[model samples]
Every structure is written in C-alpha cells, then in structure tokens.
Target: MNTAINSRIPVALTIAGSDSGGGAGIQADLRTFAFHCVHGTSAITCVTAQNTLGVRRVDAMPMEAVVAQIQAVVEDIGVQAAKTGMLLNQEIIFAVAQQVEALQINNLVVDPVMVSRTGAQLIDDDAVKTLCHTLIPKAVIITPNRYEAQILSGLQINSLEDMQAAAEIIHKTLRTKAVLVKGGGMQGDLRGVDIWFDGDKLEVLTTKQVETKNTHGTGCTLSAAIAANLAKGKDLWQAVQQAKEYVTTALTYALDIGEGQGPVGHFFPLWGLGTGDWELGKKQGSREQGAG
Candidate 1:
C-alpha cells in the first residue's frame, strides 16, 4: 500500500484472453508492457490451448468473472490505459463495454479480434454486432486487421486506397476516436502499411517489413505497446507512431522457435546485451546448412 512508489509507475490493463502458447493474447500484452516499463494488469476473458502452430481449444470465462476482474483492477491498482482482445462472445463483449463505461476507463485501445489476418471470421454475427455497437465506440482507437476492417467497413481492401477508404468508413460508422486499418495480411508493396484515420486527419503509417514467418503476435504486441505508451502519458498519435516503431524492431529480432510461426522478440533490447546476436546466429546456421 505504498502510494508513493505505485504512483510513479504507470499501470496498464489488458482485458484479453490467455494464450497458453505464450505468443499472443495476454502473454504478448504483458511482455510488451514490461518492455515499456509499465505495470501490466490483466483480466483474462478466456483460456486458449494453443501454440505457434495453431489454437487447439478455447474456453471463455463467465461474464461475471470478467466483470469482477476489471472491477478489481480498476478499483485498486488503478489503470492509466487499457486494451481488449478476443472477447469471444456477446456476453463478454457486453459486460466489458458496461465495465468500461461504469469504471470510466479512458485511453482505451480496442483490437477488434473478430477476424483473423487470413480473412477468417472468429466471432459469430451476434458477438460482432454487440462489439461494434457497445464496445468499439467506447474505445479511443480501434486496431483492426485487413479482414476485420473489411467486415467493419463493408469494403474490400486490395490497395492502399482501399485501406484508406476502409479506415474512413470504420471511423465514420464505428464513431471511435480513430481507426487503424492494418495491412499485415496484405501482399507485396501493400504489406506493413497501416492506414490511420481520426475524424479530422487521415495518415498513412508505414514501417520496414521484416521478412519472417514469425509474426504470430504482431497485432497483440502493437496494440499493447500503444496502451503502454498511453499509460506513460503519450498522446494518441505519438503512442501509435512509437508503437509501430517498437513492433518493427521486435519483428527484426523475431524469435525462431516452435514448429510453426514464432513470435516477435518483445524483449529485443535485452537480448544478449542488446547485440541481438541470436538473429545473426540464425542466419549463420541457415547459410552453413545450405553450404553443407
């Protein structure tokens, strides 16, 4: 109960599912927060049995349990910012929305996890409706990947122009403060290009694409970094810009573990005294194998 020390450290909350894979969801969120020096709190909406390969099973928490976790964190530790991912159902979505309003949680970032980067819809129609109507509008910003942007804006995204259009449509319809239409699922020149649209300004944000299959947690890491920056008192634009940079650097040091796609190195700065020589080692190993 030392208010002095607690007051100095910024606190952020991630109301997301638990990924047993340790690659995405709450796991990624917490790791990103720690890398930013923010205190990370979590209210797990569900538990997933998964790994780098794929998710095997998912079990959602009860609505009441989710609500209680939010209340516990907000009332005691105090959250400066928050983000949500994988609400899983209408009940959890409705509950989270109500809690966001009731707790007056600001600096909220919503990663609309209704669709996968590969264009598969994860949530049902009812849950999607509830999220768009009740939860999304409460967010300061919503980060939606390519397919999710298409679903929210009812437009196809094939080019930068299409991404800009989708961002505009999503901003106009969802009424969120801003919309980030992600292009991670895109191809060729369009990949790694994100479109940002606030009510007054529309900007194209781009970063160098790291060519690797280990992009499993990029979305979660990006949104969580945004929340962490917000908690540290950065404005929305600065938070977003810095977060994108962080994610790109993380991708550069993407971990090459597991049988399938791995995760970006959330602790890249701490990797072997900041040398990040593991990446060099990986490249050397590959070249040696080819030569043999």
Candidate 2:
C-alpha cells in the first residue's frame, strides 16, 4: 500500500439553512464540526427568523447565491466531506445536488430534514420529491428521523422491525450507501434506538435517552458529527457510533438558554467532562433550565 499523506487539517462543509435561533441548521452543524476539531465551511440556503418557540419567517437565498457560495467554498477550500440539512425548496435541492455531482464529492451525508419529531411537516411536497430523486442518491449515507423515514419509505414506524423495513426501502429506493433511521420519535423503549442498513446487514444502534426538553438541534448535531468524523478518516460505522456517543454526551449537558426548548451543550468538553466539572455543570444546567 502507498502511504502518502499531507499534514493538512481536515475540512467539513455544511450545506444548509441559517437558524437564527442558533440551535439547529448551519449553526449546529458548524458547532458540531468544531467540537470534532475539524474545519467547518457553510453554504446557507435559507435564512430563518426562528427561536425556541417556533419559526417566525423564512427567506430563502436566490439560487445563484447558494450556488456561488458552494462554488467558492469548494474551489478554494476543497471539502473533505460534506453534510446537507434543511434545503429549503426544490430549486435549492436541485442546485446542491448539481454542485455535489459536479465536484464529485464522495463522502456526502444527507440529513433529510423533512419533518419534525412532533410529526410536523418542515418541507414541502415538491422539495421532498426532489430530495428523494436527486440529492439522496449522491449521499454516502442518509439520516432520517422516524417521521422523515415514514414519509420517504411510505411505512408507519411503530417498532424496531418497522424501522429496519424503512431503512431497507430507503437504501434500495434512494440508492444511498447506508440509511440510519432514527427512532427518537418512537414511543417508550424504542426512543433512542436507530436502525442502520447498508444494503447488507442491519445494525440497531441504541443509546440511553437523556430525559431533557432541550433537544433542539439533535439531528443536525449528529449528522454533522458524522461528516466531521468522516473528514478525519473514520470508517462509516465508527463515525456513526462515535457521533452517537458525542450527541448523547452533549444531551447530558443540554443547556436551557431560551424561553422555549433549549439546545444541547455543544461545548460540553470545555465546561463539563473535560474540565472535571460535570457536577457543577449539571447544577448550572438545571438552574438555567428552570429559569427559562
């Protein structure tokens, strides 16, 4: 084997919308990337006026602007891996798919942000169809929560078997290398389980669910962590497993900053475990959560 490598820092790109709330979308992606010690780049698709409560308004960037941002980032910076979240509409999705194809980006992670954990539709029907047709096939893996998986695979996910079936369908239909059907929205014991299928064996990755209302940008964080790990040369399964652990640890330090649902503590390493101050962090987190 030829062993030739340079000393360049790994870079991860995020193609997504801007969340003013700073809990989800591009903000969360960049934070997760930073936590992984990877360089993070971004191309904003839409700008949303949002908060912990809900989205107030959204202004999508023009197609040319979105494309230009991606082109600029890729031409000079050269992404090692990329993850996409919250492509606002059909046009944006099509544009992103075109850029990914044109640049021949191999390690692509697609987080299909079509629906919320509460079963609320976050994207339009046209965008969903475009994503299923164009973007997903180019991805190395697609991460879809239970709600999005149900919409994409046309299955009602009520159990682990249902999640496995949905992962199979998503893999076969979307032509992606792998599918991670997240079970966060599932009721009871299935809550923190996720089904992973790579057109071969299926693996159920499970974690103890942290009981917290401050799970605002969990999906974004997890997918971004995967992309960051991929950029750092981790294998697919290892990347996913490590990413899950990071998310769980972050949830263990979830912050209560806003009036509504708060965000997971992305800098837990600086404040909690890394500094040997988890007890103090937990106490502070509780006070902040109660204050909001």
lDDT for model 2? 0.90
Q: In candidate 2, what are the lDDT values of residues 1-292, reduced to their tens digit?
A: 0112244778889999999999999999999999998989999999999999989999999999999998887887788899999998999999999999988776899999899999999889999999999999999999999999999899998989999999999999999999999988888999979999998879999987688889999999999999999999999999999999999888878977878998888988787556658768877765644422
**lDDT of candidate 1 vs native?**
0.90
TM-scores for every candidate against the unseen true structure: 0.93, 0.93
Query: Which whole-number lDDT from 0 to 100 does residue 150 have in model 1?
Result: 90
Can you write out model 1's per-residue Cα lDDT over 1-292, one digit (the tens) per residue?
1112356899999999999989999999999999999999999999999999999999999999999999988888888899999899999999999999988899999999999888789999999999999999999999999999999999988999999999999999999999999889999988999999998899999887677788889999999999999999999999999999999888877777889988887887775566767666556434532211
Residue pair clashes in candidate 2: none
Count of clashes, each model: 0, 0
Task: State the TM-score for model 2.
Answer: 0.93
Go through the candidates in order and give the C-alpha RMSD of each one to the true structure.
3.4, 3.3
